[model samples]
Target: MLDWSKATKYSGILQLYRNLIELRRNKQKNTRGLMGQNIRVFHTNDQTKVIAYHRWMEGGPGDDVIVVANFSTQSFDSYTIGFPNSGTWELRFNSDWKGYCEDFTNKGYSTTAHEGECDGLPCQGNVGLGPYSLIILSQ
Candidate 1:
């Protein structure tokens, strides 16, 4: 067990959880999709231990959110993932960011969707992913 007395409020894991909670509950950020009922699981690769899904309200621009996770032990410099629309997607959160933890390998960035057919989606984007990490992107 962990010692609660030694747990500081400034700990990386604590901050990470706070950030995620704020992201999910803050309505002013236009992230209602995280609270919405619409969801689509678009990609799942057992070999690579990766899975991706989309969450949206009405879908488009500020109302859409895409989540991708890597469960493997290896990292990828460039992994193609599908997007619902063709445009710039902002990197809202990255689980592997060094600020979240000292041992994390900071990877993942905002990417623009390009013209292509991938994972049954109309647009595709290449993103860097760290091992056992997840990234959240939004428009």
Candidate 2:
């Protein structure tokens, strides 16, 4: 039997779900484009177990979003990933944030993207990534 009273105990999980719901609701228009050719797999490295991609609505600046995922069991420091343009890319979400789970390292990162070239993109940024984590960034 399930304990109904205990359901409210997982505030962290609840918050995470709320945030995800908000993200989906706020980006609803742009998200529809994600299903089509608007999605681009920008980089992938099997050795590092990392992949990066871009999603946008009509492929414009404000609607542009970058996602980086680390599927490895190890953490990475200064992990470089490419960006389509040179500008401020805000770190919108980090799955490894301790706020999401107590076991997380809470090894937060810079809120803005760095300038450089990587994975054939005109701009790049280095980020600290935790194991089995996903990060979302946007300009």
Q: Give candidate 1 misplaced runs (Cα > 4 Å).
A: 1-4
Which predicted model would earn the best lDDT? 1
Candidate 2 residues lying further than 4 Å off, grouped into runs, are: 1-6, 27-37, 111-116
lDDT of 2 at 58: 68
Query: TM-score per candidate, in order?
Result: 0.91, 0.81
Write down the worst ten-residue block by lDDT for model 1.
Answer: 23-32
lDDT of 2 at 18: 74
Instruction: Tell me the alpha-carbon RMSD of every candidate.
Output: 2.1, 3.2
lDDT of 2 by residue, 4-54 (tens): 575578777677767666555555443332333577898999999999998
How far residue 119's Cα lies from its native spot in candidate 2, in Å, is 1.7
Residue 123 of model 2 has an lDDT of 80
lDDT of 2 at 6: 58
**Alpha-carbon lDDT, every model:** 0.86, 0.73
* Candidate 2 whole-model C-alpha lDDT, 0 to 1: 0.73
Clashing pairs in 1: none
